[model samples]
Target: MGFDTATTTLLRAILDEVCESISRHETGVRAHVASKILEAATKGEKTPDGLKQIGRAALSEAPTMWR
Candidate 1:
């Protein structure tokens, strides 16, 4: 199993943005959303309600950019 540099970079960037966003959501990422995201991530499934997406949305709504 191997990942190209581009994929690694993209993942890193997304994670960075997601983390920053999570730190700022007033409503917060609920336990259920986190759980679903974790499960999908662990299983390597295509995330339906992806945490990154939700996080970025919250971030964009507030004070961050998902760059």
Candidate 2:
């Protein structure tokens, strides 16, 4: 499903905030976080706080090359 401009912006902002501590080169981690956030959003979670929570949890559980 396609999101509206505002929702897309909100999701992007949440992704950036969640991945702030990670390197920009870490696409796997970023993708993981994005997927989680998108999943939540598609499931009717449009709230920033809720999406942030899900994004953070995804970040923590993200796969790392070193792991």
Candidate 3:
């Protein structure tokens, strides 16, 4: 399912914030975070705060090459 422009914008903003919070520069890491955020968004997580929480939790759980 496709998201509206506002939802897309919000998701992008949330993704950016997550990446920044995690200091994720590697493409793989960024993509993983983005996917997590998108998954949350698709699951009806529209609020930025909620999305951020989900994204952060996912990031914390995700296995990383560098810790």
Candidate 4:
């Protein structure tokens, strides 16, 4: 399912915030964070704070090798 512009923008912002400490080269970690946020959104988590929390959790759960 596709998201509207606003939702997309919000998700992107949250991804950036959550991945800020992560290197851009760490595609695995970034993809992991993005997928988790998208998963949460698909499950009806549209709020910024909620999505951010999910993103943060995903980041923390990312492969240790990537971190």
RMSD of each: 8.3, 1.4, 1.9, 0.7
What tens digits encode model 3's per-residue C-alpha lDDT throughout 6-55?
98998888878877856655767777778888887888878889999988
Off by over 4 Å in 1: 21-51, 54-67
Which candidate would rank higher by TM-score, 2 or 3?
A: 2
- Indicate the worst ten consecutive residues by lDDT in candidate 3: 21-30
lDDT tens readout by residue for model 2, 1-67 = 9999999999999999988898888888899899999999999999999999999999888766722
Candidate 3: C-alpha lDDT: 0.79
TM-score of each: 0.36, 0.94, 0.80, 0.95
Report how far off residue 47 is in candidate 4 (Å): 0.7
lDDT (0 to 1) per candidate: 0.48, 0.92, 0.79, 0.93
- Tens-digit lDDT string for candidate 4 (1-67): 9999998999999999999998999999999999999999999999999988999999999999876
What lDDT score goes with residue 12 in model 2? 99
- Model 1: residue 55 alpha-carbon error in angstroms: 6.7
Off by over 4 Å in 2: none
lDDT of 1 by residue, 1-67 (tens): 4446764464545555565535434334433334444444555744433647754554445432322
